[model samples]
Target: MNNIHLLDLIQGASGALDYVNSTVTGHHRRVGAGAAAIGGAMGLEGRDAADLVTAALLHDIGAFSLDLRLDGLDFEADHGDHARAGFRLLSVHPMLSRVAPLVLHHHTPWHRLPPLSDPGPGQADTPAAALLANIINLADRVDVLDQVGTRRVVRERIRQIISHNAGTVFAREAAEAFLDLSAGSEFWDKLSGDWTHVREAVDLPMADDLISHDQLLPFSRFFALIIDFRSRHTATHSLGVAETSARLAALAGMPPESQDRLRLAGNLHDIGKLAVPVTLLDKPGPLTQEEFEAVRLHAAASESILRSVPGLDDIADWASQHHERPDGSGYPHGLKRDALSLGSRIVGVCDVFTAITEDRPYRPGMTPDQSARVLRDMVGQGSLDADLVALLLDNHAEVAEARREAQARAHVEFERYRSLRVDGAAHAA
Candidate 1:
């Protein structure tokens, strides 16, 4: 695999979060821009400022459910739930360690926040991380205010809100920096433009260098969590698919590196589902034609999102083509068997297997015999690759055991995620 651009990958993953609702479309970008501008005014530059923008882009990532995301639009809402969730999700990943603490405390009020030195052993230096979190808090509120009303009206309202919240809801220094930037037309002008302008306005570096595929795994898992955790119906779907795909690739004698790539592809395959409504995903009955069409778009949407980052062309194709069929009966591109790569076929097969065997809100999982029959029917109809289907069915017990173990581990994580409200409560008290 080629080295992937870190910023592009970060931005691409961020885009998935912003895709969940129209109210949040470009919301992350706006906050990133605002935080970068404010961070600059407060004398933050280089890695500190860049990490601020990264945290801003992913601040709402913990709001996995549509309900949690929608609730965020309420300026007075308790954001502790998602804040803790985001922190836990990000803190476990090495690449996002610096950004994690900021995300955890982004909604914590300046007065209520613990001392700067509290983020002990192995944590990011808290003085900077704490300030950066508050900067993000201020920037987040500014964007939320900007979301409604005319530009002039919104700007005035934002001015009043910041002024009212300063020194309490916001750190005094961060609030002052925001006010200073808002005092001039240039800051808002740069904000009104693209993210590129916002990055340029703050002198944030955009690293163009690529990193190894191994370096991208944490992010892949992160994206998987974001994609799957949106609904209980899919809490472990991506992980299951990822495990099944990698296992299938190994059974097919694919190279270890290639197996890893397929694993990543599986993790990201449903990223486009972020654009899909939870109502549709969790519906108990069959989808109407319109709803089906909306759900079907996720494949193409996944391709579009993954393709935006460089060095992910193969990943994009493998992920997007999971819905494609040998008989050219699948969606998005509807390519025939000849057009599909082995990697794509593996993902497609794994997706089918996982979907059939996983319990859903509407139905229980099929037994192995039942699942085998279904797979045979699919292969007979040219819906799945005959060879891959046979390989899975032939090794059904091993595959099923592997998928079950993977999802069991995922279930532990999901339980921990769901239980974060307790953590939030303890912290609040």
Candidate 2:
């Protein structure tokens, strides 16, 4: 946990965001690569360069908050809501605070942006925030254009659109930088090539040092907010599960460190849900076999994303194994009781409790007796660990109350986020 690299975490989180749609599968990585190249050509180096690329990777993050789909591929779509939402979400992050302003204006037109005074001798020639943001804007559109057609056609069209929009949609310098970079076959090769090679091509600085455990909480919660905020029906689900799982872990006599890890696992258990379509998630009737199969990929998706980051193996296992059953009936993997870890069982129990108790778009939450009965039946059928199920059922009042309080707080945050989207749309209009 202590040895997790900052860049790996950021990449993993961005990877989850990429799962939101098929059209934008690797959009963030390409944008990050493009921004790095453009920023370098503009003489951005060190922190300025790194922040710009980082912001590019996360620029569309507000899509989840706004419940947006693939509209980002439409160059003329209204992106103000997602841009503002990304700003609001990133502003509170401890390590990512500096990039918030960059993400905030990633969609702003060059002509509409406020002017900035040139920095003193030691600083970069341009104000880093403004220039960095414009770099992302240019890179983003370039990648979007790249998605429209074959390489030859897309390259020509990219030149035309970028040339036309310079000084309007994009800053003149950034646009020029991008045009120059994209003229080469090398640029397109890296853009369409592997991300590791892209980083080397652009000389992008990735933070490889270990991040402290204290920093993991905010990032975990950041992910939880993104995962749950995709729909009104699920706005507070991850928080409920996280808090409930933590309480249950405590009651189970787990050590303090294990409890903290379990909390992180709880917050991120459904991260793969980002890959699932909102229609499937909110559908009222039972899922068709095809739909159920699509939904079932979430657990493996969660494990894949989490495992991509170093030193998060324990957390990843705990989070991804939440669907496993003691009788080897669970999906993604059919681990039996002997194969399941206690941490995994704890998160699994909490997830079930939260799901049954939380209100859905189609129905009200189940009563305590109803939820308890459900849990007990699962215990009896070997679907869950009996002792853990009993612990949650016996202290139902306390654990359920903790979940309520946590989700209540999360709801307020969600409402505030909604207000930001409304205000942002108005501002954009």
Candidate 3:
């Protein structure tokens, strides 16, 4: 295969930053293209543009390592370390080094830097990499809001949201420019990435390994079921929440495909919990410090296991980032504010609501009213999205009914489900 093809494969499989990649499944390459177009529009030219494109493609590599070790975590793992790890791993690759630092600190934010070369110890400060790093960072956030396809929103919806977030981290000019471009007619269609190159690119074994959307759905559901299977305390937890969330998204006028993705993400949001020891997950009482740290690794773990499965990688961000907080205090990646995709953000709220409202091993479930109150408090604190939370609360009665119905459904249809595979070979041929 050619070098470009090889690099895209490696980057795609890297699962580093969790920005625009496969964590959302059907939207994987499309999100990457969005980031790239915005980067290009920013006048990031030549090798710099390629680097941003490369970084944009594989920003979530840190997830793979974190998820791999989660299934039986004996120690408290800090997933925030993934950005640096992804940077290091790609630094060794000839094609990816330019993008490595960009990917590394995508989670660390541009404003909170101590300089790329820390004056103190050998620990390098990565925040001062370059403007491209910052540019790609903003682009990632823009695509996540994705004002497209959801009941014919105003063209300026993305702009309005970005306009509201001008200070602190994102510059008013940059955000406004992104909004300016996104408000145009052709941007949304082009934002999803230029797939013509991918189609015409030279073929390879790995390219043949690409997983399609259909194969991933069942796998995603089953993977989420594994989260419940890990302990009686959490059995069917994700599926129940998934059904609830999907039903809610449908009610709120989200497109059918987007709603399907939300439900799938809700179902698998806790798959990272699989790597956690049953001892820690099933504890009858509150977790110790060390134990809580172990609990945080599951999201990272979920990201890892799903990375290898090709087409399903986008779901990783949604399924895995379910626990991320908007305030930068959440675990896995500490992805604050606009760093999260809308689907992931929605799943985050749904995960909390479903878990709190459902029966648990240690305590009685919170009433829907009580869970609504708690979710409201979280929104007030910036832990969840107020808008999505409001949507859920608005339809809580109907969602509660769906949750009731999902209780009897198995995560899969049993006899019809099979292991996920890709027709990469056929595609290549």
TM-scores of all candidate predictions against the true structure: 0.91, 0.90, 0.48
Reference-based TM-score, model 2: 0.90
| Candidate 2 wrong stretches, greater than 4 Å | 65-67, 116-126, 149-152, 195-201, 421-429
Candidate 3 lDDT by residue in tens digits, 113-155: 2244432233223442445555555665555455223343344
Q: List RMSD in Å for every model shown.
A: 2.6, 3.5, 19.7
Worst 10 residues of 2 by lDDT: 116-125
lDDT of 2 by residue, 1-429 (tens): 458877677778888888886566788888888888888888887778778877888888877633555465577776776777787787656777667767767877777655433322332233567778888888888887777444434587888899999989888999898889878888887788754634465776565545788889988988898888876678899999999998999999998888889889999999999998888887778999999999999999999999888789989999999999999999789999899999999999999999999887778889999999999999999998999998988899999999999999988977776565322233232
Model 3 misplacement above 4 A: 1-212, 411-429
TM-score of 1: 0.91
Candidate 2 vs candidate 3: the TM-score winner is 2
Q: How many backbone clashes does candidate 3 have?
A: 27
- Cα error, residue 227 of model 1, in Å, equals 1.9
Clashes of each: 0, 0, 27
Error of 2 at 397 (Å): 2.7
